[model samples]
Target: MRTLSPFHYIVFSPVLFLDKKQNSYYKKINNSVGNDAGSFAPLSFYNNQPAALPVPWDTMLQKGRDSVLARATNNSMGINNEYYNAHIKGKNGRIKAVDFEHNTELKDFRMLMKLIRAYEVDAYFVMQPLNPHYYTNLKDLNPVIDEVRKEIKGGRGERAYDCADFFVTDTARYDKALLTDVMHFSEYGWHLVNRAVMNHYALK
Candidate 1:
């Protein structure tokens, strides 16, 4: 991984390493977000020129959040359809067969953890909730997760929280209301994640 700035905590999802194409696509998205930060800001015109004013940070953030939520809801069906096609009905549906065992993305993720450790940041890898249709053998993915946890722990002996297994323990019984798309969690789903994290860390 790339050089990382110091942070108190770093939370990420393993879904980021699912595939090369998707990984590259997300990197581009991250770059685009960085480039578009000005657009996300509440801007105003000063003498026919665009300028960022002293907008309330919370208000600007809420505006951006609302915009994204609106877009996501508006495109939910299409997004879910695409996920189904790619992960369930298409040739790539067999995710277990995908070369994630030794993927470059995994290497990058490990490097990221090492960098985080160098900064003494608390690193947490949240396992994303998979759609019930695509939910498969968790045991198969444990090796990768375990490696990540072990590397990050490195003598500190902290463990990565098993949120994925917690949510999917019942197998084939995911709550549809918790999902906007096949893979993307809805607000309620995020609430559950928040509670789980809080509980795990014994946060107030």
Candidate 2:
């Protein structure tokens, strides 16, 4: 559930988390830059559903914000600038925040930059394209994501966009129409996702 080194945190990613000690998992992604590969398959939106399993983020964020606020109030209380400063220099330095709303279950390039700048651990992020409807609804997520990116880049820098078939908007097709579950995607949908991942990273 938790690791002692690197940072004390959690990451729910669509990609595989590698095995290693001192953040090898984080650095392994750098391999993607070599050629351009992708994930084995598109992570099914079905993965986002609640099958008595880990709660989905969008759902959990909305459902638990109040509780999180309450808990923060109980613990952190007010801004202890002194305490915050110390943690930022020490504990926070070891943190790596990874988001999973995009195609590969990671944040956009901009968010990647911000997270990298905020801490000292190995940092990376991937942007997964969403279906038209969900992408339109969740597009606003880009702003927050960009904010994180800005934090990492500091001034400005270039970013790479995913070239995979992330959006499954062809309603004419019978396969996609089956994914009407609202949150999770169907099997065919994930196929395209996996394809895109492999293409992007140039994976074998």
Clashes (backbone N, CA, C under 3 Å), per candidate, total 0, 23
For residues 1-204, write the lDDT of model 2, one tens digit per residue. 131211111121324322232344334554555733343222332334454543244454343333333322212222123433533222311112234453242334435444434444232333333223222233334444454334433564433222332323232322322122222333433444454554454443
Model 2 stretches astray by more than 4 angstroms: 1-113, 116-155, 158-175, 178-180
lDDT of 2: 0.34
User: What is the lDDT of every predicted structure here?
Assistant: 0.45, 0.34
Best by lDDT: 1
- Model 2 residue 149 lDDT score: 39
TM-score of 1: 0.43
Pick the TM-score winner.
1
Question: Model 1: per-residue lDDT, tens digit, 1-204?
Answer: 122211111225422222334445556776776765433332221123545454344464455445434544323232244444544453212224124554555677667765655544433446555444344353454555555456645555644334333234234455544555545666555665665554554444
Worst 10 residues of 2 by lDDT: 3-12
